[model samples]
Target: MAKRNRKKNQAGFVFPAPLAVVLVVLAGFSLVYVCLKAKTEALGQEIKALESRSVQLRQDVVREQCEWASRLSPASMEQALKAHGLVMTWPGREQIVRMRADGTIDSSVIPEVRPPARYARVDRVVMND
Candidate 1:
């Protein structure tokens, strides 16, 4: 083929090397930023999950407390004790004696805070003279 009307091919655009390098660096920085953002979002989700678990545990504790209160109600405890043939009564003034306060435990008749084995097992110990 004969080259006809070939004046010049100087119509192409030339990109600057330093500007291209800067654009490449900017692209690298953008990639690093995107990675960090993704990691941050994942951590946020984990935090939300932990918070939900904490809330659920707190709710469970509250429910347990309400159940415990219901079980420990006066009516229920009295009924249970009566059904078990347990009689719990306060001690008379004569049954309680004061200590000498001389670093000695005064006890002529020790009061029983715990019910009999047939009833509930109380955690309190009553010391009286």
Candidate 2:
């Protein structure tokens, strides 16, 4: 770009009209490009930070699950039962009650709960062929 000589009183050179306008436009574009580049870099940094946090959280969850599983092993459960002095036994025949296929419960079992009137027969009815 050619710079024209200014008047003797002026300190700086003057640019032609067309050249000045072009220079102004180029400067505006440069400013916009710099702002956009900075924004893009900021967003990239934020994404990297979030990804690192997500990975750390996942690792923490896996570690916690492993610890939980180790604490609930069969041997640990047996030791806990012995520590509490609790006896382990199977249910007796009298403690178990058999259910009948009919709507009425087994007579051997007391306090039979009869089904509601609507539930007496659940067979579906066909309509319109």
Candidate 3:
């Protein structure tokens, strides 16, 4: 009877060792899962902040472009040109003169202006090659 009782106690001890090993594995896995969750949340917050900053920069660019356009109207451009002693002149007609390589000259008539200017009835000349 003493021998049988000793064997039964040894069997119970063997079962608890495996159960302890399983608990240790489960604890390690739980720690890893928690770490990954925290890292993912931090990365998501960073992405949101960067996106908000990008949107604000885009809005600032659009506002600056509109302000510049409002200040640089046609009248302002004309005034600035005149301040530099530069005047816009329109050509009425054109006469093309071509010179040959052998010192010969050939002349032809070309209509350089079609429609007149907006405010002034002067003809604008456009040269094309």
Candidate 4:
């Protein structure tokens, strides 16, 4: 038995192992960079959308406050009462007694503003002669 002489291989020069590894690593880094860039852009869009939503919510709050204030106006309250068929007559000039600077309607009447229950209660005494 005898081994036959093979012809010289004609394959082109192959890249060295370390160069191939470096190229693969560079490609991987480029791919990671592209993925990170895309993620950042997506986050930016989300932030923009949230900011617009917050602005809309603030505007809605302001609109609601304005509506509440208008509804609470004296004219609006009177209009609502009239719509409900309720007639309230103002007091006659003779019936309306002006309060004194000392918060007394008369010797027997003393007006007081009470604090909420969470505070300590204090009894007020007014001496009348």
Candidate 5:
């Protein structure tokens, strides 16, 4: 009777320690996995935010380029030139007045021109003596 009881007790207790060890190892692994999962999720969110910002920056660049293109169009340039009294005459099509040896255009057909004087006005103050 004692031998049978001893054998039964040994067999039943054989798996407890190994099962407890396995449970502990599994718990530790689960904790590590949860931490890693959380970190990976955070990194994914950051990547998504950066991608959205990059797209927005690209769109802004395209919009600015379009605006600049419109502003620098040939018609706009011609209008600006007209406002300044400048004409885009093709090469060899302009009326070239020949310059004389005195560094002046030939006065036979062209009149001599002079620049206007520039002046600034100052207000005078009257003081009582």
Candidate 6:
């Protein structure tokens, strides 16, 4: 009876250690799959957000171009200049200066006809009491 029991136990019986190892391997694979799925979903959400932001940026660019177009019209420019109280006039022949290809003034211009300085000296009056 003892010999028969030993033969039955050793014949085609599954061991707990191999079964546990297989279960652990399957669990590890499942964990890795879940992690990859989560990462893919995160990347998809980021792509969607960036696409929306790009669309908004394109709309903003269109709006700015339209605004600039209106601002750049001749009438609009004239209005702006008038608002700033500036007077535009044609320069006289003596006031006009020509430039050469080398960036020097043309020899035909008189040396005595120098353009007005950007900032002139202001004379101050002093009162001695």
Q: What is candidate 1's lDDT per residue for 1-129, written digit by digit as tens?
A: 868564575655779889999999999999999999999999999999999999999999999999999989999899899998888887665556566779565686555565433445668777794
Q: Output the number of the lDDT-best candidate.
A: 6
lDDT of 2 by residue, 1-129 (tens): 867655554856667889999999999999999999999999999999999999999999999999888879987777788898764556545554667787665867654354533424567899998
* lDDT, model 3: 0.75
CA displacement after TM-score superposition, residue 7 of candidate 5 (Å): 25
Higher-lDDT candidate among 3 and 4? 4
Candidate 6 achieves a global lDDT of 0.84
What is candidate 5's lDDT per residue for 27-96, written digit by digit as tens? 9999999999999999999999999999999999999999899879999889989998777765341334
Query: Candidate 3 clashing pairs?
Result: none
Q: Give the C-alpha miss distance for residue 124 in model 2, angstroms.
A: 63
lDDT of 6 by residue, 1-129 (tens): 445666566657576898899999999999999999999999999999999999999999999999999999988998999998765667767777788899988978754656674544568878895
RMSD of each: 11.7, 17.4, 14.0, 13.1, 8.8, 7.2
TM-score of 6: 0.56
Backbone clashes counted, model 2: 0
Error of 5 at 50 (Å): 2.0
Clashes by residue pair, model 1: 97-129
Q: What is the lDDT of residue 47 in candidate 1?
A: 99
In model 2, the worst 10-residue window by lDDT is: 111-120
What are the runs in model 3 whose C-alpha is more than 4 Å off? Answer: 1-15, 89-129
Q: Tally clashing residue pairs in candidate 1.
A: 1
Could you tell me which residue pairs clash in candidate 5? none
Candidate 5 TM-score versus the reference:
0.50
Better of 1 and 4 by TM-score: 4
TM-score of each: 0.51, 0.53, 0.48, 0.60, 0.50, 0.56
